[model samples]
Target: MGKKKFHKIFISMLSFILIFSFLQPSQASANEGLKINADAAILVEAETGKVLYAKNPDKVLGVASMTKMMTEYLVLEAIKEKKIKWDQTYEVSEYVYKVSQDRNLSNVPLKIGEKYTVRELFEAMTIYSANGATIALAEKVAGSEVEFVKLMNKKAKELGLKGYKFVNSSGLNNKDLKGMHPSNSGPEDENVMSARSTAKLAYELIQTFPELLEITSTPKKIFREGTDDQIKMDNWNWMLPSLVFAYEGMDGLKTGTTDFAGFCFTGTAKKKGMRLISVVMNATDENGKGTYNSRFIETKKLLDFGFNQFELKEIFPKNYEVKGHKTVSVVKGKEKEVKVHSKEPFKMVVKSTDHEKYSPKFQPNTELLNDKKQIVAPIKKGETVGYLAVQAKERESLGYLTKEEANKARVEVVTTQSVEKANWFILALRGIGGFFGDVWSSIVSTVKSWF
Candidate 1:
């Protein structure tokens, strides 16, 4: 074979290999321990908002003090908007004092005459699940618990948390009234929320108020202002300071337990460059006891499965070209060939184990024009004439258009240079001569038919 023919064959082979390499599919690694005994659970990546695992995640089950996440979200928004100052003193309201006095419920032990900073109350409520502190801060910020609940619902809607309801800042169950009061009022209402909604709310809280971690992660905090005796609240999260593999980047979210709601917890943990939010609700002890340790165990299992199974890999760099379109023909253009280029890069998430096997596909749309196939005189640059598309394993991903060149100027028919060259006039005169010749041929053919 001639040298030029061998070179052409080698180039064709290389092009085929490149095209095959860009048309492979990516796969995810298999995950273990996906089964957990909570009524509903979800594990999601905080940065990309990708769900790693979910089991009945959207089921609307009661989520106890996890409701405090909404309360915390509003508080942070208030602080960010300058509506509430962290160090400002707030007088303990009558309702807050009454709730604090109740030994059956969680309390920061606020006194009737004493004052506490908004930051301290927030710490108690978020770290210790202090019901009284939650209500006190709500009233201080919104002037009433009812208004705070309204704000919570409004924010929930704004966050696109569907199927969520908040009757109070605290997730306490409302009293059921079988009979009407003397004033003939209607039956009492109740507060409720779902595990999925709880997780979304907590995720938003951590994203908005990262400073809340300083309080939530603290295993112990002591309040020394209200009563003769100091009140110390230990963080209820058992996984924070107890477990051997307990993640370091873990922080305060909330835990909830009631006879009706069972054990519930929304946990947020971050490590390296990844953050995960897990929610477990309706977990019960082997003996049917409502406790949070069960929820914690399930959450840990989900997080472990996520960290062990998959890893994020960037397949392509930003603005990297994947492929280019074939040369296209344009009529009356100075440029003979126009090549199309991609405007953006192509990428895909693949399993670490499957990195060698996965491949990407690039497809560019090229169409043949009906005009001149050779260099002409009228094409302009950067004018869009056609488009190109990219695909992965036959699946179309993105598409963009090809532009014309700007440097190629149009050729005028009647210029002084063209007249001087004589070649332009010769070609124009030949075109006119050919037109007259065709007309004369047609007349002769008609006369021959009559003969």
Candidate 2:
């Protein structure tokens, strides 16, 4: 080959290699330099529902026993609404008895014709992930497991969880129930949820019922402390303090594993007043086996990234005004324009390096504006005239969890002082003066045009 031709071919191949390298799938995206080993994962700030990081977050996957978080939410809601009491006793059903007796599944054996308090069953389900206990609570709350499954789906919809399904109260595969799965659900069905939805569910659950932490944080408890059937119940979530796979600041959460679901976890931790919620679905080891600790390991990567990389920073102070939008025009008021500022402080979880990337995006409220887009006089101080939201300068911002949250994310901008209407005499004088001014201006323009 000619030297020049060879040089050109080599340069083109080098360029192609560089482009291909750039297109390769990265372990993470923009500022999140951590690699997570899971089919789907997400980490979010608990207070704001702002997603800090995500990996295939919307991919639908079997959530295994992480489905129990929904069950826990319903049970807590029932107690709060006075529909059921923690002390209420429930009779063991034929379905619950059979499932509880299976040693292969997680359960605290329940004998038929015996009564157990709601608190007992809840403890078992929450702490040990006892499938039968979860079902018993479901039956007690909704009259039948079938109806309870309906309630679960209803509440999931109400909560705005998208593309989620609950086949049974327990996160077990339908076949695990030995033909006692809820009616209308396939025998092979398993509960499924996206990592984003799963994290949102956990966020809402904790925000609504903060007291559930007292139970889930327990490392171990006695299922029937003094009875002959007493069994030592150990929490499936090993990330709690003092647990085998404990992580600092980790607390109440749920874990799951099944043949189809692999291992999944919905974990939360609080440190220095910042709480983070994370979900890892189908986590596996190097061998692709969903070992017991694989979920925790993947979860730690997320929590660590959140805690170490992000901080709750005040993006804008309360009453701060955006540049180029610091004031709004007012008609027939004491002032031609009025100063406007944010009604509340804008705070969000963001990386330290990201402060420079954010800029204010101000939107005016058209309802309060005239055809000229000027505010009418008699405006009240602190009135909402506009909204201010932040935009990332470079990179796709991880938005809020829900539409409602996205709407609420902005800060209201209000007038700094009220503007009063001008008096009729002054308005008439200005109107008459303005007429002569217009005539003179027209005459001057005509004179200038002629010259």
Off by over 4 Å in 1: 1-33, 176-189, 225-229, 242-245, 285-289, 325-351, 355-451
The residue pairs that clash in candidate 2, if any, are none
Each model's total of backbone clashes: 7, 0
Candidate 1 lDDT over 78-123, as tens digits, reads: 9999999999888987777777776677777788888888988888
The TM-score of candidate 1 is: 0.66
Cα lDDT tens digits for candidate 2, 1-451: 9755565566557545433433232335632567778899888889887777778878999988899999999999999999999999999999999999998999999999999999999999999999999999999999999999999999999999987999899999999998989996999888999998998899999999999999988999988799998999988889997988888888879999998989889999999668999999989886777788899988888888888888877899999899988999988886789999999998877776777778888866655764455798988998788888777787544556765555566789999998898888877887899999999999999999997
* lDDT per model vs. reference: 0.61, 0.86
